[model samples]
Target: MISEREILVLIPAFNEEGRVGEVIRGVRKFLGQSAILVIDDGSSDRTAHVSREEGAIVVSHPFNLGVGTALQTGYKYAVQEGFKYVIQLDADGQHPPEFLPAFTSKLKETEADLIVGSRFLTGSEERMSAIRRTGNKLFARILSFLINEKLTDPTSGYRALKSTVLQFCVQDQYAFDYPDADFLLTIHRSGFRIEEIPFRVDPRLGGTSQHSGLAPLFYSIKMMISLFVIMLRKKSADSN
Candidate 1:
């Protein structure tokens, strides 16, 4: 079993100055000042400074890269720093830190390479637009069929994974735009083990989602294409 020191809490933030701090504090409250890494994705605001002030290790990008890139950065850092496990959640405050223990416990018990927190599995619904809700269900169904597993929320950002999984994710082939369903599907197809646990998602505390506006429409199309392309490609030889 992995010790607390082997785990890292990674939060990717872009323009989430006020909310990110709260997220950091919440993690510290449970984990007791564990190694919390915040990837400040080129925010024009003081996101980096605030994260540092909250006692999190901050890695700042010079310009705004998408959330996928930010997560890749965090994974890269975790691998380089020799973290045995990584737990990532949104900085928008939607993913509650209270669920961190549940993720850790499930990871320890199942020894799964990846543990995804599902908002739908517990019958708890997060307040989302009708279009987003429909899109999530559609993607979930498709991914479940593809993976041959009963997955409820494939687009969930709250997740925990072993560092060995990051070795593949840090590669250039990993998606950089919106990792969502495509990311999870690629990992699952690559022979990595993935499991999901139910968790409650709170409303966003501040700032707009990168997926706001016409992005969702583009995301849906792009994700479908990406998912199929992943299916066509051969599984990675480097997979565990």
Candidate 2:
């Protein structure tokens, strides 16, 4: 219902040619003129071509950069292009675009710096195991303890942010892992307020779910350690 805000949606896709087009189409159908950008992280597949053909502005990387790199590209584009708001979504068709209206509506009203779309905060349409849900909750608790932020879903990719907030700070420009709560700590250290919006999740259509096993292990160790180091540095900065 809230149409007063202008926001751009950035989708970081890597070899998601089969699924990116549908995502763009769904986003366009739901959010006309809202601007969508698909960052192709050096995908060998037809990701860039399909995205451009589907009316999404495409930015391609020379090779397979991680999700963090793609996101940074999207952030830079959003900042340079004078966009007021930016929502980051996946290109594999897991994010339910139907719920975007609620996220945007809250962003307009709350003036929130970062708005994260949460699955545990609401119902999920996709089938998930209890172990995964428990892992998410326990991780969320740990994140709340470390960062002391009221975050429910630290790993949820469906997230929104004001352009000003995005401009405030970022870390590990290219080598950053999955981001999640650890990356958000960068914003928290900068003293920005983050909001969480409840949303549903759906099964992906093509490609594969990227989060699992060693990738997640890498994400947890590197991203957390990096954030911890940042927290200490931030504390030092505050003292001085």
Candidate 3:
């Protein structure tokens, strides 16, 4: 059975050698009482060392797994360690640690199974690339329509999930990037509640963006096609 109320912050990092420490420190400040786990997905830099020095529990992957796999590793750790909640944040420093409270607050207010830190709700236009921002908005709107609930930032990487939500996330064959694309379907299929937390994004402290133009375009298309397929399958099953 899943535990209740406890939180474990999960930091999935890749090649964030310079900014990892600051991001971890920022998170530690907000999560003063919460547990933290840093999944170093085969960083080619000192991300692991820096994160450990900053007081985060560092778990290293043998090779660079995709972001999805890194997240799954954290989730597995949370499940094993008996944590009640998990927060997925980037180590690149774009996702401010100060905004963690918004997610925790929404969790309490709505008793939601998943809480996504959304840039739209908080109104950030500073660093968002036009194409990427437009894609996120379009995807969020599409997901909201599909799930029958408003999702402010469907593709936002900053998010929190209740432990019970792990059941859906851990199934074999579950792919990465679901947190951005298939999150609504995963929760809706499992009868879990999802909420959005408004948060203003800050400019990344160091390193270039891991995703931007071509990455966002490809990812959006892949997710949309997958979502449509799932919906069609669901519809056929329902009708049957």
For each of the candidates, give the backbone clash count: 0, 0, 0
Tens-place lDDT digits, model 1, residues 152-234: 88888899988768888888878658777888888888888888899988999978776788888988998899989899999
Alpha-carbon TM-score of each model against the true structure: 0.96, 0.89, 0.90
In the order shown, the candidates' Cα RMSDs to the true structure are 1.2, 3.0, 3.4
The per-residue C-alpha lDDT of model 1 at residue 172 equals 84
lDDT of each: 0.88, 0.77, 0.79
In the range 44-146, model 2's lDDT, one tens digit per residue, is 9899999999988898999887997788888888878878788888888889788777877788789568888888777672355565676677668877887
Backbone clashes in model 3, listed as residue pairs: none
The TM-score-based order of candidates, best leading, equals 1, 3, 2
When summed lDDT is taken over every stretch of 10 residues in candidate 3, the lowest stretch is: 231-240
Error of 3 at 217 (Å): 2.9
